[model samples]
Target: MKDIITNIIFWVVGAIVLTVEFTFKFNDTLGWLLTTIGVILIGIGFIYKSKKPFKYLIEFFINFF
Candidate 1:
C-alpha cells in the first residue's frame, strides 16, 4: 500500500519532469539529463504491481499531445 503511493509519486514527478522538458527549452545537457532521469523514474514506477502505472502513462501521453 505504501509502496503503491510511493510509486505513484514517482510516476507523477516523472511526468512533471517530462512535461517541463517539453514545455520549455533548457540547456542541452540539462534537458537530456532530466529526460533520462524522468524516464528512469517512470520505469521505477512501473516496477510495482498495479494497473495504475499504465493508466498514468496513458493519460500522460493523451494529455501530452
Candidate 2:
C-alpha cells in the first residue's frame, strides 16, 4: 500500500512537472534528466525482452565509432 501510494505520488509529480515544462521554455536540466532515464529504461526493456539484444548493442557501438 505504501509503495503504491509512493508510485502514485511520483506519477502525479512527474505529470505536473511535464505540464509545467511544456507550458514554459524548455528546461535543460529536466530535459537531460528525463532523456537519460528514458534511454536507460528503454535499453533495459530491450535487453530483457529481446533474445539477442547484446549482440545488437555491441554492433551498434562498433559501427557508431
Top candidate (lDDT): 1
- Give each model's whole-structure lDDT: 0.85, 0.60
Error of 2 at 53 (Å): 1.8
Q: How well is each residue in 1-65 modelled by candidate 2, as lDDT tens digits?
A: 55445545554555665555566646688876765554554455435444587897898789989
Task: In candidate 2, list every pair of residues with a backbone clash.
Answer: none
TM-score of each model, in listed order: 0.67, 0.41
Q: lDDT at 32 for candidate 2?
A: 65
Candidate 2, overall lDDT?
A: 0.60
The C-alpha stretches of model 2 lying farther than 4 A from their native spots are 1-29
lDDT by residue for model 1 over 9-57, one digit each (tens)? 9889999999998889677899999899899988888766666767866
Q: Which residue pairs in candidate 1 have backbone atoms (N, alpha carbon, C) closer than 3 angstroms, thus clashing?
A: none
